[model samples]
Target: MKKKINPSREWYVLYVKSRHERKIEALLKENNIETFLPLVKTVREWSDRKKIIESPLFPSYLFVKIDFRKESEKVLAIRGFCFFVRFGTEFAKIQEHEINSIKLLMEIDASMEVENNHIQPQVGELRKIEIGALGGLGCEIIKVNNENKIIVRIDSINQNILATIPSSYLTQLATV
Candidate 1:
């Protein structure tokens, strides 16, 4: 039996109706369920004006923290909340680091890569990162493509998403 704790919170992602992401998020928050919706800032044009909007990076998806094994039924019964992300019999836990990254990312202009795998990092802003357990290595981040993959070149090996670095254990690479 899953142990029940008063605040047995673990990060989880829920699939919801697209465009209903914010609505579901608001509703859940009102219910005392802590939630997070990762979004990217973009401009949307109305008839007379162009307005900036924060839109979901992952459509139909939102993250939350709750004691699911104990409160699973409550979360599932929520209208418009499609389902909790799962793997077979267990609800998968969202990496805490991802939560932190998403929070910090919201405060800055960001880009993602995956399908259209190309990153054209700005000239002065190009940062060479010596990361991971490889001791010290060089990586260049350019454009944030559609796939959310960070294109990095390590020792002439072009890689989509540097395979080694922990997003949290980063130290700045000194300029030559």
Candidate 2:
């Protein structure tokens, strides 16, 4: 009997060659595969001038929506494709809400910074944003330069989104 393929589609992270995120996204789109490449704009100063350019929020990483069991070979065959982000032996699957949260952050155009490999020991109280554009998001408060900052951890991606939020907007969550 042939092995079964899952028909349901889900989001999975793909690791691609350095600086090849846009290229991979285009290639996947051409093949009718759904992809999400989150990008952010920043000003870069050159020796002669300064210009604003858009760059991938997460370097060398992008998200794909597919039934891995069905499309694994095709996706892997693409040029610049490295491998799927995995946890131990199993592939890492991203939650839809997490994707939406990222989208929401981008939509609001919030001043944000991405910290990769944020595996430091957890510090400070876990609080929820109660006001402003970031309201409803759970974050951890950390002291940066003697000032409080909120870190929204996207555990699956091993990243932390650092943003400066006013103290009044934060409410400490009751520990169980």
Task: Give me candidate 1's TM-score against the actual structure.
Answer: 0.59
In model 2, which range of ten residues has the least summed lDDT? 113-122
Off by over 4 Å in 2: 1-7, 112-123, 130-136, 144-148
Cand. 2 TM to true fold: 0.81
Local distance difference test, each candidate: 0.59, 0.79
| Runs in model 1 lying further than 4 Å from the true structure | 1-7, 45-49, 111-176
**Candidate number achieving the greatest lDDT relative to the actual structure:** 2
RMSD of each: 10.3, 7.5
Model 1 lDDT tens row, 1-176: 98455556878778898799999998887787778887777799989999988888667878888877776676776788888766667665665655664465566544322232233444233354443333233444443332222334322111122322233323455677
